[model samples]
Target chain A: MHFSPILLHIPDGFLSTIVSLISWAITIAILSVAVKRTEKLDEKQVPLMGIMAAFIFAAQMINFPVAGGTSGHLLGGVLAAILLGPWAGMLVMTAVIGVQGLLLQDGGLLVMGANILNMGLLTAAIGFGLYKVGDGRKRTLKLGLAGLGAWLSVMAGALTTSLQLWLSGTARLDIVLPAMLGVHAVIGIGETLITVSALAFIFRTRPDLLDPAEGPARGGRGWIFVGAAISLFVLILSPLASSNPDGLERVAGDLGFLAQGKDAPFSILPDYTLPFLGEGAFSTIAAGIIGALVVAILVFFIIQSLRTAKKNA
Target chain B: MHSNIFDRYLHNNSSIHRLAPQVKVVIAILFIFSNALLPDGDWLSFAISWAVILLLNWLARLNLGYTLKRSLIVLPFTLAAITALFSVPGKTLTIWQIGSLELILTDAGLIRFLSIIVRSWLSVQIAILLVATTKFPDLIHALEHLRLPKMLVTVIAFLYRYMSVLTDEVIRLMRARQARSAVLPGRNGGGSLLWRARTAGNMVGQLFLRSYERSDRIYHAMLSRGYSGHLRTLNQHELNINDWLIIALAFLLIAFLQLFAHSIG
Candidate 1:
């Protein structure tokens, strides 16, 4: 009857009906989108996806020695995201979580929705997002990012769990939140190393398995070129600029200006007017709108190109 | 591979087992929700709920001792809830100065902690009852009927079916590792921590490749037989008037008991 501390599966009565119901609503919304998208997958991927779910389940059974004589198992959100795409990976995690709750009694049935959201949807989404942080070509970079992604995914899950417990009045946020984060930060290191090693091994052996949904690596060069061009333009033309005196100054001072700076306060400039016209809230909004539009357009083209690339492949 | 750990489904011809899987799932959720919604420290409600759960267990023909033993799985969760005993601020019943910090236990905290434990125990008991009486696949079919995403259900079905196979594969891999390396008989028997981890990582990589290739072959085989994306099977669910009556009677009783407990408490 002893359960490992590393499991983090919330049992019943920990969450109120309101929290559980809201979680179920959000989980169902995401899962419905996942189902709709995956429905368009090739029929050949049917067995592959199923077997991948089994692989995750089996992988979890293998326990590795963590710090202090205790053992821990893989959550496999990042692994699934790397092997499959995020959508499919989320589905696989959902299935794994569901089966664990239903059969193994690892989690409570009432709280299954929250568990899935924390361990499945959020982890897969965040991990996949971090995995895509680096370019897909370099082996070392991909593996490194995968490790980071895996580590962050665990922390994110832990954070979400603590927040949910706090919201449910199960525990005080001041006590449980710090405790959960501190414990999970160390646990996340083990996750990172395991994920890195596994990904490196797979990349060395069969890189084809690493991003199945990404299809072939066509137009990547073109996309990089486009990205560089956009970056150059943004760097030169951006009005939000504050140069740091030195590395020491930047470290001692705020890092807020490292990205976009604070917008102007007043509405002297119209929203469409460039920042050069006036230094007001309207210009800041205009600048923000312009930046968002550019990014959206770029993402749209990248996706379109990837779809065509997949067709070619 | 320890497939025997599974097959918890008890073969019984009781009326509880005869109810549709969807009905049973709904009833289980309702029971858990009702138990959870009850006011903390309402021992009357808790007692009534336990009595009803025990009744259902009897109707299902499950062993009382086994059911009680199985319900002990909620113990770990109770430990987590126990933290509230010290952390929750209220009327201090006891306080101990340990080193630099003071650990205080309040009456309200104790009540909340105990309530959480009892509620969880009761909820898990109902869950165990549902899973113990219904077949696994039937339960999954019931989920499908409940409109869980198809992709999720499909993955669950395959994961459940192939988990044992993959576990067997893992056992073989471990056996191979053990045969090659022998050290002490206790923990960390065969290798250092990093070595064991590396071997595990390799095994995982190997398993992924194997499962991947197997999936490809399976897909090809299925395709040769005109396989498509959708999974179709014969529908065997049929609900009778007895099922409806049982479900309705159970809900009505639960409602009445809850209302009575609320009014009295």
Candidate 2:
């Protein structure tokens, strides 16, 4: 079986009852908020939102070939979030997913809530959250941020799906977490490329559609906090992944990174932590925080340099 | 071209088709829920649920072979559950030794994996039966009647209405791309993977612009036709005696099935 790990629409029976219920609760809550946020939307915008949902549905059909005869398609969540604001983008995604489940039977009805939560709500939040930082920025900078948002949105979806599977006892955490992330890490690159290109196309043509003033207002810095919380959660869970060394070895072996089931060539954090901090939970978290800070600072400097370069130009 | 295949509803006057959309929707979801709640390796319950699904398919007067084939859509997703075949622990069914590594498959693991496949298959069939028997418009109406959020309902209505239109647009775009992207013998057609992705992305962007423009025209047309903020539908279905009877019967049947399954297990 050609197991494509980026399975977006989760069918039924994979998620346990409790997990499904929780996901449904979370999805419904967020959707209710989205509904309230779009309450004052003009009647004219309704058809536009609907048509946009259809557009996303159609856009997903254009599959580009990847290596080894496998193909990947656009998820369009981040793209929608960029065009529409986060709240409306989320609703559009919900509509698309809902139609997919009810009409096409692409996903299971029972698990549709989790499907929406994973693919619709989370992607919209992350995508719009990160993309909004590019408001009033240079075109390339905005597209770059959108690309980063798109890639992270895919990773977020994969991470949540792995958690759901593990929670349902359908798969082991050690196995599914890495497997899902590893595959999506590559697929996320495709997501980034497609999203950036699509936006670039939009930037060249009908640029008014991307105007923040025309779209919904930004949601402030709330999304950054959400992203931070999610990162922390992932950091907490990273230890569980590294705990099963055998799982990593097997994955490395399958990817042909290691020979004869041997150890990895190198480790970034050496079991996801600094050697000085030792192998405790606290050390792992501290290392993750430090690593995040370093990356953030580097990104800050890069953006600053880009702004200066644009000024000089 | 494949857009028509997505409209799985058969325009038939069978009993299942004649049932109220609300009732069918409720029962379908309940059936899926019951199936999800079934314990792994609960073969008896699985068998009973499969029987119920098959009976429903027969009642709907759908082509059994076609429905079965459509339900196979869930099989590819079963790959997501393949890890369970190796992860679950129990009596060792077999072990494969690759080099110094040992890969073990257990009886419990096999049962768990098979049960997941069966459960997903049965649940998907229930969904198929629901869609096959009810029209998409009626399904939307049923959701509205069931008190789903008004905005969501409206968005779904629009999506269903315009899916085919935009899908055709997409097909045209793809055909255009194909016409332009010709490959020489023993050579790749596209410049590179990135270029191909960019080409597809451009198509998507073009499609979005078209759809957006069409939506503007659609809204104006609706406005001219006296469309207010709220959408009013002609078919307002009330739960009649038969609808109530079917709901009650379904509720009892599902309850009994679950109770019996648990009792035996």
Candidate 3:
């Protein structure tokens, strides 16, 4: 429901089915592990997780004017990760992304896995790791590092999205990769400022809101240096990146992805759904069920094998 | 701008509304998956999928105009796909030069772009229809039945319940800020951008504390009532014969269409 002018989610049909399915598998695997890690959710933590998710959701709606009369909203992945642990943060994000897709149609159901992996998994996992790098140091340093982590997290998500699109043959990596990384590099600055200032407020008002180990410190020189470096990088890169906006409109009038799809003889569906209906009344339906069962069993075995492999290692 | 335009579940007695929530979830996913898998430029398949979606909308007694408007949320994504026009290398149909930069239009690229747009538009429509018919909590329930993690489901359920409460709290906080300050921060006429942002950050911090306290109280209340970690809802999702038939028919429809498209190709 929070529609920021800056958008980067890869919608359905943009990625090939194979890429999307693989993303789904990876996402499910990570989330299931996350579920295991957080299995014994303290009775107190459940409501905290819910309310934090809601708070993040509500905070996203309150957009601030950035520059040139345009506005931006918080992604909250790093913020949630800093406030909560990384695993719980990922869960909060997963729920947020799921709700956005299912209720608001912000992203497609077919591509939810990819969306979650890009915006949720990458941002939290990498952002949190970078955040802890400055841990056991100054509080100002920690906040500055949080800002840097938030910024880099957005860039990482953009990079992953570009890679997926390139793999899907939607766009050439040379063109879209730079365009995406450049745009997100600018947007990540906004992410950084919001995250740092919010953390600063918690540092001032409710120090206990943050984890206890990150003690308050005095100097903010590290914060100033990091912030300046980010701005310098964006100022140098964004203007050179302006050509991409017109690239889409200028290149071709209109082309169909399925133009060549119709000429191809092979279809992946038949291999999955056998033509068993030729024999009996319900054979087609039976074949469909059998195919579904086969897929389920295949997935179960794969997961089992993975568990065993992990145990052995 | 915060409105209930999203939770637009209408009160109507229609077959689409009557279907179990899980069935609807399955149907929507299957429909989207099938549409995404459809061959690019396969106009026949696109038309059939659109027709089936429209028929469901009619069955649900939803306003066509509203549904269409809601589906336009996919436009920004379509803009992203437009990049494919320039980046996809193929046989050139037209060539142009912009500032010593060569740009070429390829038949294959254009078709790929259009197919992506069409497929995404269709998928959005199906998704919108699914949400419009079912209650939000019921959708979460369906996800639980589908074996999504219990903790994840519980988090989502609480989010749905508290989203409105927290939104109202934010509205109140903003109103207080506006009343105290001479100019509304961050708008057209306001204080410096950084000052306004700090104020907003403080507001967020305050909201988090308030929500945290409220959750503590809520948890205590639940404990007084012998609350456990798990939340239980009365079982109301009993699948019927019609549900099975609908599932079968939907799968068959998808299979038949894919098979038909293949044979013709």
Error of 3 at B49 (Å): 0.7
- Evaluate model 2: give its TM-score: 0.88
The CAPRI class of candidate 1 is acceptable
True contacts kept of 3: 0.57
For candidate 3, write residues A228-268 as lDDT tens digits: 44333332222222212233323332422212111111212
DockQ of each candidate's interface versus the true one? 0.29, 0.51, 0.25
Model 1, position B197: C-alpha lDDT score:
57
All-Cα superposition RMSD per candidate:
12.0, 5.7, 16.1
Candidate-wise lDDT, in order? 0.69, 0.77, 0.70
Quote fnat for model 1: 0.57
How much TM-score does chain B earn in each model? 0.90, 0.95, 0.91
Among the candidates, what TM-score does chain A have in each? 0.67, 0.77, 0.67
User: Cα miss at B111, model 2 (Å)?
Assistant: 1.5
Candidates 2 and 3 compared: the better one by DockQ is 2
Best by DockQ: 2
| Candidate numbers, best TM-score first, in rank order | 2, 3, 1
| Candidate 3 chain B: worst-modelled 10 consecutive residues by lDDT | B95-104
Fraction of native Cα-Cα interface contacts (under 8 Å, chains A and B) also present in model 2: 0.77
Candidate 1 — which residues are off by over 4 angstroms? A1-5, A211-313, B1-4, B87-89, B184-192
TM-score versus the correct structure, for each prediction: 0.80, 0.88, 0.80
Q: Largest lDDT belongs to which candidate?
A: 2
Writing each residue's lDDT as its tens digit, candidate 2 over B118-156 gives 999988888888888999999999999999988789889
